[model samples]
Target: MSSKLRSIRAGHRSVISRLLKKFEDIRDDGDEPVNTEELTKIVNNLLKKQETLQKLNEDILENLDEGEVEAEIVDSDEYAYTLDGKITQIQKLILVNTSTLSTNAKDFRQL
Candidate 1:
């Protein structure tokens, strides 16, 4: 994982945290007081952001797949191992976030 990629991921995490906070705030305040239109807009924005992040992660995984082959051919064991670890982490992040976002979508529909 390069420093730049790590930074990008950190930014994504921050955005997700803020979105979750908004959801929590709505729930705590009692959903009745929240404007339905506004809530719909917010959820739509969050879904868009999640989709963008998912695509970015997918791109990273593809790049890593290419690099992994190169690293193996070059006999760079450490670099190959690092790439493997990164691939695993990114896949896990995608899976976890996808499930979370799906849950959020369901909750929004219920409102």
Candidate 2:
């Protein structure tokens, strides 16, 4: 049982770490025209990992001694929400950049 708990904790950490790295990569590449296709792939991957993270959180709570189930649930839910927000921010950034690029292309062609 202890080993199971440790595995779940490790998995949780791995997923979160990967998610943060992906997010940082996008931010670090800022001001460059993003490859929408690649960005979509990253977002899709993030979503899947986020789901896995939530599941791991559930597994963690299951292994707990049941002293603060409600609080843990709230914390996990909040964490998921925050990740969702980050995903949305990335999506919006891509949309804005794509739109700007489209406009610039049109203006250049007209000149």
Candidate 3:
């Protein structure tokens, strides 16, 4: 990773740690006793998700480093799509298919 990006990520981690510390301090020493276990659980879950995303990003970077990304764009003169049209099209797609289907599958679709 680039040094600049690494520094920014470190800064974010520092800020999050500080905020979590402050939250625990408030929960530990407040006028009235408070339950912060749920909040702690949420914070931990968020941290886990962050780590997982970071790992995914690293994996993606490694894959990209292996080769260049190929992309293409094309412009076409097509009719503008509307929500209702798309909904109807999707309904038809789900309700039936153009090809063959099994009897059990057809029965399930009826149900």
Candidate 4:
């Protein structure tokens, strides 16, 4: 039972870490034109991981045995909400960037 809890904690950490890294990468890229395809892929992957984490949280809560661990999981779940907001912002940036690029291309052709 302890091992199962440990594994769940580890998995949550891994997903959150990966999600943070991706967020940093997108921000670091700044206003430079990014490949819409790549951005979409990253967003999709993050969404899947987020869904998995959410499901894991539900399972952990349902099978909760230890009182201390429940507090930790709740904290993690709150952080996950923060992550979702950041991810949504990134998606918006991607859409705006793609639109700008397309507009510029059309303008250039009309030059």
Which pairs of residues collide in model 1?
A: none
Error of 2 at 109 (Å): 23
**lDDT of each candidate versus the true structure:** 0.53, 0.72, 0.43, 0.71
User: What is the number of backbone collisions in each predicted candidate, taken in the order shown?
Assistant: 0, 0, 0, 0
Candidate 2, superposed: residue stretches over 4 Å from native: 2-6, 100-111
Comparison by TM-score, 1 against 4, better one: 4
Which ranges of candidate 4 are over 4 A from the true structure? 2-6, 30-32, 69-73, 100-111
lDDT of 1 at 99: 51
Off by over 4 Å in 1: 65-111
Which of candidates 1 and 3 is the stronger one according to TM-score?
A: 1
**Residue 46, model 1, lDDT:** 61
Q: How many Å off is the CA of 92 in candidate 2?
A: 1.4
lDDT of 4: 0.71
- Regions more than 4 Å wrong, model 3: 35-45, 56-111
- Point to the candidate with the largest lDDT: 2
Error of 3 at 106 (Å): 58
Worst 10 residues of 2 by lDDT: 102-111
Model with the higher lDDT, candidate 2 or 4: 2
Estimate candidate 1's alpha-carbon lDDT, on a 0 to 1 scale. 0.53
C-alpha TM-score for every candidate: 0.49, 0.64, 0.34, 0.67
